[model samples]
Target: MSHRQYAVTHTDIEKLNARLLSISLSRDERDWQSVFHTHHFTELFFVVSGEGNFLFREKLYHIKTGDLVIIPPYMEHTEQSIPDTPLEYYVIGVDGISFQPAGEQTCVQVFCNVSNKALVEEIFSQMLYEMRNPAYGSDKICQDLLEILILRIIRSQHVIPVPIASTYMTKECARIKEYLDSNYSEPITLDTLTDLTHMNKYYMAHSFAKYTGKSPIQYLNDRRMQAACTLLRDTDHSISAISASVGFSSQSYFTQAFRKKYGMTPIRYRQSQAGDDAANGS
Candidate 1:
């Protein structure tokens, strides 16, 4: 028998300092709604099946099976499914690490039709199983699996993982942003936000605006409007129904806001979108 020994070097296997925050499998059924949100940690979104669109940076990116999207911290994003073709996917949240592609300053990256689809699916499946059925050392197992996942992603996708530094202000802003994103439909005011963040209203507003460029109320309204646009484009819901669904109690007020944002009434905006789709044979 012939044997060859290979010497290992420290640079060959650098230590990864990332930690797993959370993981969940998601399925979007009919009329499912997704809100634009941000996280203080890096998020890896792996599409398992069905077709959908990923909304990021004010643009829509078509995502389907085998698509992997890496969202860096503090980036606003959301995902929506097609009418009948609902989206099923896994979201893996990892703290202390972010991805950066070579020669790019932006941290966001999307890899379509990944080469190792089967392996990626297996990793996620095993992680989900472990999460659902925990035992001794399961948490440690999950963390190790997360490291493998990150390493595989980096190797296969040719991206670099950078460590993230969390600050008090950044964490606070992220918390408030996440709260607003998940609960935008609820009635909220300055007092509500103050209570949530436990900071003076003016200071909280200033800090949030400094990070997000929009005041708390403005951000809430914009988030509502974004959801409204999605509903108008994808669903046949009535203006009144859509308005109420997205937090506006008054159809007239919703219409006015929509017009101001889009330079057209809600109905007209829908018609224009339809016209555009037909013209493009979508």
Candidate 2:
């Protein structure tokens, strides 16, 4: 894979949509061959297991488990499996993205030996599941994930790594934030945080607010509300379901908190977003 980097603008991302033409989960265990072919739209080719070679425009590239190959539109390519090992892979084709090749002429680009193959696989799995079931805003969800996949491919190249906060969190606050980030979908309480971190409630709350500019419970609720917004905009799940899924004790309480924060009911917020989607032809 060449370091053929290209700039992605906000417009490019805004043009994104997940109206996939087709997606396939295939396992090629034995030797298999395919004639050179091209696609009308872009593709994300992920190798889940086995070994193989991908022939892009007659240049052979060694491929195996954990390889992610991006094939731009009309990029002639074919694949074959190793004699004993098959190529288990997913093929996702999508429309409405703009790509420009980086320096040097290259037939294909690859993100190999990916560290987050499972995450990639899970995103694709969820997308395919949603596609088959046709949930509300499912295409948007998948498209958003496709954008993530693109970002992952760029990240695997080691150009630069995103930075995390270097500011110290008084041990307890950091622990609480980590817990809330992972378990915000589950019940949380001051007692839970205090017991888990072995800190007094008053101290924990004070430290968390000091470091993060919000109380521990407020931060947890913020996370839950963020997740709820996504669900409400993307899924047809009832407001009550969204409430419980994000760890709200009750639908009524969830509504109250949501309105207090966003200044509108959950249903109203969702409907507003839906109208925006329709207006934008999304």
Candidate 3:
């Protein structure tokens, strides 16, 4: 379903909370920091114009057109427009993150090294395209591509220390979040996370919960539901098919979970979107 079609009960449009999606135009002469706030979603800012620095997690990082700044869940961050140009970008907040253990670990790093700016540009370009000519599943595909770009940011960044936590585990946490983001389709257990972090399972889970507010399993399930919602709205796929696709083992269980979180059955939600689309003459 189109993200706009979701019956969002609590969307923070200034920084789209929960389901990572936003687009904004910037005035050419404005610059400042946003009111600092924590979100329950991960954010991606793809600058469309101007230059700036994002103050995130007590570290200042530079930004510009085509640059991406990722603010993970519960991380306090904001934008600072550069001297000459005002900052603008298509911003999106996805529901969860995954960690990839193999990459050069970075904690709150900005990605300026572009071996492939063209690829990053193309991803944002496609976002513009989808917004203009939305097809079946286009929103879902755009969000997936956004996920890829954020993953690239996590993998290709250089580490900079933030004051919230001591130890290299901060970097380790970033890697684990990236890993979880990439591997969300698979089963994630304490053993899986422990092996990835090279720490004790109980200790690692506690630390993750301490920093990220949700246990690893809770994070994964939330991501799965985010994916499931997109699928149910976009594809003709059955509820059972989507449940399995997002790693839920049972249709009934998925339905129960979906209703609890979104306040409607999957089928009913899809039908509602269909009704709205028809009413809008789309």
Candidate 4:
């Protein structure tokens, strides 16, 4: 979460990075042991047939047959199967590809996705065909298939900021989103965001609203609420502590914001969620 990290604004179609991504249709059983790890590259897992709960950071993401989960770079996560059925799945390790910007300078981007089952099947079929044929044009076909896979994932998910119609627009908006996500604990202002993107405050506000479906302040508040939701569901922190952690200047303001968003106070929401989890034996 560096402030000055390069943003991914465009997709690389030609010269896509190739790697030996392996898939497994069977595996042995295991216990409720922790398997926490992080990787520099992105990883994707599709459960073709299985049932499990994936521990993503502090939240539990329930996964099952045909479910896909994309683990972003440096995500600390693990999965545990809850059913006795043998696990079967597709796992892809993304490789970074080099791309030249409009200035002719090169940068690398690691391709990854949150989840898209249709695209996964299409790409898997194409890859299997290429592997079986190994004809003269198989390499090119595989490359195109990989591009399709990346595009499908990008189109279907909202986590990563993919290029829109314009590259500059994407870059500017990505800078704003990245700043909000990385520095949600700090107070931000229109002047600060405008300075970061080098755009006029008025124009930046309007354009951001048009593209992202939210004004800059609204987006920041929504991000804060997202963090609050995670804390309420996973942590033993008090309501005031969670509010402070998510950058709300005062407890009253945080309570009002949480009530407005979730139709309940933070303490009530946390209690309800905890009761549900307990009832489910989680």
Tens-place lDDT digits, model 4, residues 1-282: 657777789855544343434333334366336576655445556776677777854468777776766664444577777758655666666545212223322121222334556657667667666766689988677666766766565456433332223212356876786787789879888998998999999999987775445799988898899899889999999988998999999999999998998899999998999999999999
Compose the digit string of candidate 3's lDDT tens values, residues 135-155: 999878777676566555645
User: Which lDDT values do the candidates have, in the order given?
Assistant: 0.84, 0.74, 0.66, 0.67
Clashes of each: 0, 2, 16, 0
* TM-score attained by model 4: 0.56
Give the CA lDDT, 0 to 100, for residue 64 in model 3.
71
Q: Could you tell me the TM-score of candidate 3?
A: 0.46
Per-model TM-score on C-alpha atoms: 0.62, 0.46, 0.46, 0.56
By lDDT, rank the candidates, best first: 1, 2, 4, 3
Give residue 270's lDDT in candidate 1 (0 to 100): 94
Q: Is candidate 2 or candidate 4 better by lDDT?
A: 2
For model 3, the stretches where C-alpha displacement exceeds 4 angstroms are 1-169
Per-residue lDDT for 84 in model 1?
80
Full-model lDDT, candidate 3: 0.66
Mark the regions of model 2 whose C-alpha exceeds 4 Å error after superposition. Answer: 1-19, 29-33, 98-108, 158-282
Worst 10 residues of 2 by lDDT: 159-168
* Candidate 2 root-mean-square deviation in Å: 19.4
